[model samples]
Each structure stands twice: as C-alpha cells, then as structure tokens.
Target: MKPTAPRYDAVIMGGGLAGLTLALQLRQRFDDLSVLVLERRAHPVPHAAHKVGESSVEIGAHYFDTVLGLKPHFENEQLRKFGFRFFFSEGRRDIDGVTEIGASRYLSVPSYQIDRGILENYLAQEAARHGVHFADDAFVRRIELAEDGATHHRLQWTQGGETRDTEARWLIDACGRAGLLKRKLGLAQPNDHDANAVWFRIGECITIDHWSDDEAWRARCDPQARWLSTNHLVGAGYWVWLIPLASGSHSVGIVADQKLHPLATIDTFDKAMAWFATYQPRLYEALDGKRHLLQDFAFLRHFSYGCKQVFSDRRWALTGEAGLFLDPFYSPGSDFIAIGNTYITDLIAHDRRGRSIEARAQLYDQIYHSFYESTLALYQDQYPLFGDPEVLPVKVIWDYAYYWGVLSQIFFQGRLTDLALLGSVRDELQHCQRLNLAVQALLRAWSGASEKRNRAAMLDQAAMPWFAELNRSLNDRLDDAAFKARIRASTAQLRQLAGEILARARDCDPALEAVALEALLAHPEYRGAQRLSAAPQHDGAMLFAVPAG
Candidate 1:
C-alpha cells in the first residue's frame, strides 16, 4: 500500500517504555515535529505491581541517563550501585576477582525495580514535556497505509464510543511481546524455540550478609538501600531475581522453562510461593517465610520474536520488542527500546535535514540486527551452564566484565559510533561458543572413565590451555590503563576487518566468508575436539539450541 505525507510527524502505538521513549527522543531531536502516543490503558500508574526486566546492566543504565537526558531523575529515584554478583545453585559457591568480569565497584547505575505502569506514567509525562501528545484508553482497531506511499500512517482507533482516524507521517510499533503490527503485517517470526517465563513480585527481602564488612556491600544491603538487585541460577532452565525498590519494598520472581516445571502453575500467590519452595528453596526462605504477592504470575512464550524488516516504504518502524527480542538474561529488553529510540530519532532528524530515510533505515536495521545476533550468541552459549556450580566463577566473571565493559565504553566514554565495540562483543561471544563446544567434547570422550579421573584429565588437558589464555588476555587487558588503550585500538582494527568480511560476503566470495566465519567460531584458547554442527554462516550469529533428549 502507498502512503501519503501526514500532518503529524509520527504516531507511536503502545505508550509503554519503547513508545514513550521513542516519542521523547523524536520530540527532543525535532522541536517542530508533531508526535502522538496512544495507550490502551486508561492510566499507566501502578495498581497491581508487576516485574519486567529489573536489572539494567551498566550500558542500559548509561543509555537511559546520557541518551535520554534522564540521568538526573534516574539517579534520584531508581539508581543503585553494586559490583555484579551471582550464585550457582548446585553448590552455592561464591567467586570474586577483579577483571572485566570481576570489576569491583561497578556502578549498578539506574536499574529499576519499577512497576511498568508507574514507569509508563513517568514516560508519558516526560514525553509531554517534550511536546508529544499522549492519548490513553484508545485501542487501535487497524492501520491502513495511504496510496501515495510518501510517509503516511492511518490508524483507526476506538475511544469513548467514538471511532477516530489519526494520521501521521511515521508509525512506530512498541507494542512489546504482543507484536500487534508485526503480526498484522506478517513480518513477525520466532527466532528460537519457544521459551516461557512465569514472573511476579514478592514483598519479602533477601539479605546478603557475606559482604557485611565491605562498605559497598553494607550500603547495598542496608534497609535504606534503594536499588538492590540480586540473582541466582537455580538449575537448567530456571533462575530467580530479587530487586529492591525505593518504596521500601522488593520485587522477586522466578523465570524458568516449561520443561523444567511441567506441573508448576501460578494461579494464585500461594501457589506461586509453593512452586518457588519446591524449585528455589533459598529464594523462598529469603522472602521471610511468607511474603505478599504483588500480582498474578504472568507467562511469556515465543519470547524471542523479530520482524523480517524493521521499517517499511510507507511510514512505519518497529521499536523494542516490536522490532526484536532475545533472552532477557542480560536485560537487553529495555536497553533495546532505548537504543531503538535513539536510532529512530537520528533517522528522523536526517530525513528532516534532506537525507534519505530509506538509506538511513536500511543502515539502522543492519546495525541493530548485527548487535542482536552477537548478543544472542553470547546468551546461547551461556544458558546451558547457567545453573552449573562448577562453572559459577566463569559465568560470574564473564557476565560482569561483558556487561560493565560495554556500559563503560558506551555510556561513560560516549563512543557509540565505534563499531569496534560490537566487534569485541562478537569476539567474546565466539570465544564462549568455543569453550562450550570444547567442554561438551571432553565430556563425551570421558563418558566411560571414572568421574574423578575424567574430570582431572579434562581440566588439565582440554580446558586449561584455553582457560589460561582467556584469563591472561582478560587480566592483561583489564589490569592496566595501557591494556585498555590496546583493546580500544585492537577493537577498531577488528571492526575494519569485519566490515571487509561483510563486503566479501555480499560480493558472493563464499570461500572468504567461510574462512571468516570459521575464524570467528575457532578459539585458539580452546583445545579440544570440535562438536558437529553447521559451519557458522555469520560471524556473531547463534545456532539454534539443540533441544535436550
């Protein structure tokens, strides 16, 4: 369908995080551009509290503060600082060190244990301050593009028993997991096998006395601690998160796969608590025997969905989960929303300044997709071992380093234009994949050997070489200022190499592309037999997880 230029610059559907954030970005970037936000709910204020992605790693927090100009309020209301911490359920061991993965005193930044409803209300107010109009309780019936296709979106919505037609030059989909426009356009496709989640908030608090003597830990655990967040991997396909809010309350929830809890049902607070008791006794105990449940448990399946195209010839773009979602293990959900908002605003500004929207949109899509693919690879490699006690140190260190490193460069340094950052991320992801494959290979080789002998042999022969190299690389790079400088230089060079590789792929140089993909998949630090799988098609792309037998 064709689209005609409309009176308003953009119309944002679903006034949640993505919608309101994008609206604010658009208004901030272009003073004269008119933007309208439509929300289905009458008021976005918290009634029954809910927990979405509560832990915002450093980069996510940085984006919120620096890009959105929301740092001040976030610091005041929702921000907290803690060096990253995680627990392995099998042995409940603690691993601590100082590296990218073990940095001490990393800012917890401004992650929220916020009610989505309350957050949306604040976002609406912020958007209003930027001159974006907001309409609540307006459910959109359908969207029709104009005939000319010159940037137009027509929305049919029902509000107060009246059907109204709203038109805009651009339409943004921030409808989250609902994927309203994505499904309507037939652009939505599942990225991975269905993953389900059951999440709700509990009023109980979990105290960590282990760090009682550490000043940082003491502050974080204090009753007055406004932004306390903690997490633990319970077992395969299950994890728990605890987040403290400013209201002198905490939010607790568990996310697990249906396969892990086939009989678990969260119909009531008591049922949810009982399920937690069965699966995560420590967390259940930390909640002080009996805790108040804030809302009914919610399930999310088909969790990772993305559109084939994020933008159209007509005036429409996807943001947040409407565009793409991966596993929430790293709290990328809200980060993507903020990132998309920034990108969309930049595209709009370029268009207003006489640049080509199509070209900008294409570039935007490529960059976003590449980032998503790289991140997904990282998560996929880590998910299987999330609950393994033996690997707790590895997981904690890797996660902390990766999360804080990105946050430091992006937010603290304000270096978003550096493609090197993404390249480094790709490198880390590939390394992780290699480690996982090597571990699997060693396990299979030792199937008939005694557990102690096999474990000792594998540790000494198969894992140590790569583990040493990784440890050395991490320590060398993170231990000194010179190492950080070297990393930045190396990353720049790598990004240039990646660009060339991308060009080769496009030019149909299959052999060269294959070589590059192999290089990405091969980690010299890993010394073990290779697992059988298709050669990588893209440098940072994740192969789908093999289902458990």
Candidate 2:
C-alpha cells in the first residue's frame, strides 16, 4: 500500500514578512496546530539591502509591535520612525528653502523604520520558537489546490537537492510577487494607476539635516532627528523617498507617474543619477559621490495591481505581494500584509471549529477589496499634485485623517471582522468612502486652479491638538458600544474635515467646482460639525501652506 502524504494544519508558501508573520500568528493563537513555511531564500539574508519595504506606518507598526509581540525587537533592532516628512525641493539644492510638511515632535502613537533583513531573521527565529516548522531555502515547485473542503491541498517543493510533498488543510501563498497561486488561479488584475519605481540602497545614511546650513531651518524639528523620518522630496508627478535603516544603510527610491517620468529615464543607476541631477539636484549631488556603495538596484514598471480574489472558501489564500500591491508612497505594503494575514487566520480558525467559512470568506474578501479600492483612490491620477505645495499639504492632512479616522480605528481597535458593529456603521462607512473619493477629485481640481505655492515654512501635522489626539486614541481598547460611538464620531470628523477642505479650496480658487463633495456636505445626515474650533483658522498664519510672498 502506498503511504499517504503527511498532512499539516497549514502550509504557508514563502517565508518572507507576510508568511513568517502569519506563521507566528497561527502558532500564537492555536499553540498546537502544525504550520509549515517554505521560503526560497536562506536564513540570515544579508542585512541593509535585502528588500525595499523598510518603513512602517500605524497599522503595520501595530501588527508588528503589538500583534506579533515584536516590540522589543522593534525598540532594539529598528529605528523608531519620526513620522513622514516631505520637502518640495524639485530642482533646487537648498532643501530648507522649500515648503516642508511634517510633525514638530513625535506623535502619541509610535511607528518604526523596519530593517527587512533584520526583522525577517528575527521573525524566523520567533516563528521557530513558537513551534512553526519553518523550512528556509525551500522553493515551492507546484501547488495543487483542493477544489472542495473534503480533500487536502497538495504542495510540492524542493530544498537541499531533495524534493518534498506535503498535504495541508490550508494553503497560503505569501510569495511576494512570484505570485505562484495568483498565476495558477488567474487572479492577476490590472489597475488604472500606471506608476513605476526604482529603488536601491547605499551603505551609509543620507542625513537630511546636514544638507542645509540654515540654523532656523535646522531648529524646526525637536531633537533635530530629521534623518529618522521617511523624507520625501517631491516634484510634479514624482517623489523621491529617503528611508534610514538600522543596518547603517539608507533605502532610496523614486516613484513617478509613467507618463510624466518614463522608467527608461531612470531605470539604471547612472540614468537615475542624471534624472535626479536635473530634477532633484541636491539628491544627485549627495549620491554622486557614493555610487559605488549601491547595494541592490531593482525597478518595477506598473507596480500597482489588483487581484481578482485573495481569500477563498476553497481554504486557499494569498497574502503580501502574492495577492496585490498598491503604491509604496505611504508604506502600505506591510499594513496590507497585516490585514490580509488577519483575515486568512480568522477564516482558518472558523474552519477548524467546524463552522462554515464560505460566506465568511466572501465577506472578508469584499471588505478587503473595499479597502484596496479606497486606498487606490488616494493614488490614482493624483501624481500631478505631488509638487503642489498649495494643495498637497491639505491633501496629506485629509489623507491622514481618513486613514486614522476610519480604517486605522477599525484595525487598531480589533474590530476588523466585527460584522455586527461594521454592519451597524455601514452607511457611515460608505459615506466616508464617498467623501474620500470626492475629496481626491477636489484635490486634483484644486491643484490645477492654484498658483502652486512653494515657500520655506513648516506644516506641522501634530499642530492640531485633535489630530494628535486621534493618533493617541489608537492605543485605547474600546468596548463594542464605545467602538461604535467612536466610529460614528470619526465619520462626523471626516465629514467636517472634508467640508473644510472643500471650503478652503474654494477660498483659494472660487472656480473649483466639486459637485459631488458639495452634494455630500449638503446631506443632513453627514453635515459638517459646527465649524471645527479645533481646525486652524483661515488666516495667513495657519498650519497649512500659503501663497509665497
């Protein structure tokens, strides 16, 4: 009699950030469930230059620090992020002379700059310590997914010149762009946002504080730790990111609209330098001396994509880049991974309990796609406003408010899969989504109508006490009633903020007609809260960008 394949509870393909985190989460939750992670790359991958996703925002930070219990590692091994900073220095070398947007001090909630190699290595050890069977250097060769719940899924992989086969009740693809299951199942879908990116790492840090000698400019940020922030040097249709790593190396990348800046212009290291020379000369000058320190150079054209389905009732799923990828402008790669892995883990839990997961899987997929679509709206066709100091600052504020007010609230409060609460606030959620869409359109129009102000001033994000409070509120553990009330309050806040944005845009450019936003504001159910006293007054001296003198 032929021996049957050994079966495990879960088989995770690819032991990168997504897979490793999922494995850790599963073991943490189930304790005794058998989980296997197959990773093509060997352990102890080289530090400082292994991957591009080094920055972490609120959701990703919470997932890593709180969910995975890696705060000690984060505090010790990673750089605590100083929040996002931006400089509208397109062609000039005097970066301080450009309009700056960031916080004056660290906000209430904390985030970090992750070193991918370091984090992955530590995650592997943690997952193993948690009793996950992690197999590094195992390349998945083939996957035969079970069509029904009755049969187990088959996974074939090779490691150390030996082939191995395993059967698993759950097969999860966290392959990160190899998209093994995504290709086999024909899940790849194209999105409208056609953007490109090229990133490489240098052996040493690129300190932005030392770039300018302006004493007043240098004194703006408390602690003068500008190097720790994810600094964005912006231009029309393009932005360059500077992210510092704990490994003493810095990650740098240029993300741009394909039509405005073709990939061919900066696909290679030499071409990137030349492109920067003409567009961001300061960065060009900084890197011109250290080209030899380039650790890795990789570029992706049309990087943003959609997946037809990620979670399925078939007991299979995709996470990380294996599913879909949006732009890295806000460092959302890790956040999506967190969200996806959570949904996948929840579905598995349901299945293990003998509860039907078909409907739950579909529901989670819909909700997940809703998130993807909303985030896509933030980036689609909005690159033209990257350099618009007059509009981009407001856009950034609105974007953060939306992120923190709605999505972050749900995730941070552990209400991601709370159906009853979500259903109760369904209308408000839909209204917020509509509000975001309208605001994005308004921003594009506002940018077109404005004079494109660029001045040497700081737009401090934490200046608004309420905004700082919102960031701080993420740490609060809310009961169901309080959570619902919070969601309602957040909806109202987003409505008021949207109204303020629209009003401000009209103040700057009266001809700007945002019909959809106006209609939404007109609705009685979603009216702007009595002119936000917390909001800065519309004076020349405010926390927003103003016309250059």
Candidate 3:
C-alpha cells in the first residue's frame, strides 16, 4: 500500500529504549518535524518492568545525562546509580591478593534505576508532550522501499482491526534484535561468534542485599549490580543476571552459547531452568522453591549486527540495536540508543532545508559503522580471556579505573566525540586484531620451539612497547606535576593501561602489571583517586597536581 504523500518527517519502528529515545530526541531537537513511533506491544503501564538491557555503566549514563540531557527526568523517575566492580578467579594475585576491585559510586547529577517499561512510558509521554505521535499495538506487516531513487518508504500496519498505511521521508529502525525493518529490507545478518542468551524474570528470590554485608559474597555480584540495582552471577560459557525492581521483585536469567547446548535439545522452561541450575548453583539457590516465575524464558541469537547502510536516498536512518550491537559485557546496548538519538538529532537539526539528504545520511552510516566495528573488536578481545585464572589482577583493576575515571566520565559528559581517546580506541582495536591473528598463528604452530619462541618474543615485544606508550600518554596528559601528584592524576589512565596489558600478558607476570596499577591508584599523594580534579579550561579533560609540602 502506498500513502497519498509522505505523512511524517520520520517513522520510527520499535518502541523499546532505542526507538523511544530517538523519538524523544527528535522532538527535543526539531519542533516542526512530524515524528511517529510504531510500537508492537501495547503501551506499558507506569512502573511496569520490561525485559531488556538493565545495566547502565558510566559511559551509558554519560550518554543519557550529557549527550541527551535526559538524566534529570530519569532521576526524577527513579533510575539507579552504579559504580565499577569486577571479580575474577584468574587474576587474584595482583592487587594485594584481592581478586575483586571496586570504584566509588557516581551519579549523573541525578541517577537511579527505573523499570525499562516505565522509562519507555515516560519517554512516550514526553514525546507526546513535544508533539511526537505514538501508535501502539500496531504490527508492521511489511515495508516497501521505492526504487525511483527518491528513497521513500511505505509502511503497512494493522490497527483497530483495519489495515493502514503511512509514508515517511525518514525511517528509524529501533526494533532491537528482531531487526524487523532490516529483515524487510533484506539486511539482516548473523553475529556468528557471539553466544546466545536465554533469560527471564523470577520472583521472591534471595537478593544480593541478603549478602551485602559479606564483602566476599558481594564482590562477586558483578558491576551490573550497582547500575541496575541487582545482583548477578557470572561463569565461563554463560552468565546470570539479577535485577531488582521497585516492586521488591527481581529479574533473573542466564545467557550462554547455543552451540554448547543445542537449543532444540531444551524445549521447556523447566528444562531451561534445570540447565541453568546445573551451571549456576548460586542462582538456583536463590530461586530454590521461590514463588512462581514472573515471565517465560526467552532466547536471543545474533543479537549483534549493523545495517549495511544506516541511511537511504530518503531521510531514513537506523538507531539503537537496529543499527548495531556489541557484547553486553560492558552494557553498550542501551548506551548506543542514547548515542544514536543525539547524533541523529544533531544531523536533522543541522541539515539544510532542501539540499542533498543522502550525503548526510551516508555520513551518519559511516561514522556509526566505524564506531560499531571498533567497539565490537574491543569486546571480542577483552571478554574471552577476562576470566582466565593465569591472568594478572593489575589489568582488570586498572581497566575499571580508567573506565570509571576517564572514558566513562568523558562519555557521560558528552566529550568522547572529541579528543584523542576516540582515535586511541580505534588504534587499540586495530592492534587487537593484529594480536588475534598472531595468537592464532602460534596456536596453529603448536609444539614447535621456533613458533613458540617467535610467538613469545612477539608478545613480549608487543607488551612492553604498548605498555610504555600507554604510561607515557597518561603521564603526558596529566598536569606536569611532581611524581606524587602526577601519579594521582594518571591513576585512572595507568590502571586502564595496566589492565589491558595484564589481560594479554603471560600468567607468570600478570602481577607485574597489577602492581603498577595498584601503585598508581593507591599512591600516597592520591589517597582517594575519585577526588582528582578535572583539568581546568579543558571541557572534558582531567589533571592532577602535587600538593606543596
């Protein structure tokens, strides 16, 4: 079905975080732009907890607070705050014999946890407040793209037991892993290497608060606890997450590689629960004989992918998971939604009245694609061996510090788009790709001393040079203070570098990197690394200075 004319400036498919956020941002940026969000599910009631990504790290929060200026509203509605925490069995001997590390909690002016459903509801209400229209319980039957090169899109949807059609100059796909629009456009692709996830919410379980006083037990909760205000269980090949809601209930589920356990073999929810019970005792213990399950378990495969093209000859663009996804280890899923909203709003606002829109769309595609690829590479390298016991603790600690101290701060403050960090992240991604190739070569040449020696030497050379460069970069970035003050300012940078290095270093020397991170973070001059000041006059930069005697 074709419409009489393009009825909307943009049509957003999917009402999840990504779609709703994009709608809100569009409304915020352009008052005259007619926006319509097509959501499959009925509009959820206020405070209803929806199943989706719950964790929001510093970077994610930054996107919401600084990039989109949505934090104030979120805080008013009860979003949770989080800090950084990591636990590992493999890297315990590095940081004073502690396997787990934590950073001080920080909020985005105002931050707290809210039901994703509630958040979406608020965004929808706000969108309406800004003159954006939302059509709920409307299923998109098909999307037809015109071949005339005008880049127009025709949408077919069912509402009120009647067929309806709508036209839009721009299309935004925020449909999540389903890739509704991508499939309609023949752009859906699989993420072959990633693990599958099957998760559900369960109730009346023993919460993390049950053991909060026990530092040892609480440390294993993973950082998501702080962000989502829940406890989680992590293990090799799979992980379990527990998110607390205002209703005193919890969201719990397991994610794993389907190849390891064929999906066909497990047909029932009981079977799925049993499978999780076998691998995750803690989760099972919490849910043992608990009240009825809240929701049926669900599975997601190929949760990561980017549209071949984000924009079209028309004004269409992809946002959120509709655009791309990486590993969830760092909770980049929700963050991308916020980021896409901001970027798209900027592009639309700055676009000329009637000039070539394709160029702007193409630029959006290119930039987002680059960012997606780079972030994906980072997770691919870091997540696999992050749990290896032979690894050192230094890198993990420092990595958290850097994420908390700098990268996260910059991201939430909307300053990541600038500075050398973006370039650095890109460079690090390329370097990791090379390292992966080298490691694979060594694995294939197993049992040959020549190959072994070559691999070792290459690794060793790779280690020292990059580590030294990282240290130098961090040191140089800090205010030219005395050794002590410089150490304080660079603590986050030092820890981040050490974490990256130690993660890839030989097990025997993991502590070497760990000790370095510890020394920097716990240096005498910087008793509380969190208190380090932001570099004056440098928007998003930070600087450390030595105190005069």
State the displacement of the C-alpha of residue 27, model 2, in Å, after optimal TM-score superposition.
0.4
* Cα error of candidate 2 at position 334, Å: 0.8
lDDT tens digits, residue span 129-204, model 1: 8898888888889887656644566778778887777787778888776777888888876666345565665544
Q: Per-residue lDDT of 14-103 in model 2, one digit per residue for the tens?
A: 899999999999998899899999999988888988988889999999999998898999999899999999999999999888899999
Candidate 1, after superposition: displacement of residue 235 in Å?
A: 2.4
Deviating ranges (above 4 Å) for candidate 1? 1-6, 81-83, 90-115, 208-227, 263-271, 291-294, 399-549
TM-scores across all candidates?
A: 0.71, 0.97, 0.71
Rank candidates by lDDT, best first: 2, 1, 3
**Per-residue lDDT of candidate 3, residues 1-549 (tens digit):** 654744787889888778877887777667788998888888764343466676675556555655567777666664464433333322111221223333233322323444676667777777788788888888888887655765467888887787888887677788776677677777755554566566665544344445335554444434425434433343344445565554445666555545555554344567666765565544455566663655546767645555676655455567777766776655667666665676666566655366665665565566567556645544443333433322312333333334443434334434333334444344333333333333323222221211111000001111233332332232233322322232234443443343344334433332322333334434454333442343211222121111122
Error of 3 at 282 (Å): 2.7
What does the lDDT read for residue 237 in candidate 3? 46
Quantify all predictions' global Cα lDDT against the true fold.
Answer: 0.54, 0.89, 0.52
Residue 167 lDDT, candidate 2, scale 0-100: 93
Residue 474 deviation, candidate 1, in Å? 17
Ranking by TM-score: 2, 1, 3
Highest lDDT model number:
2
RMSD of 2: 2.4
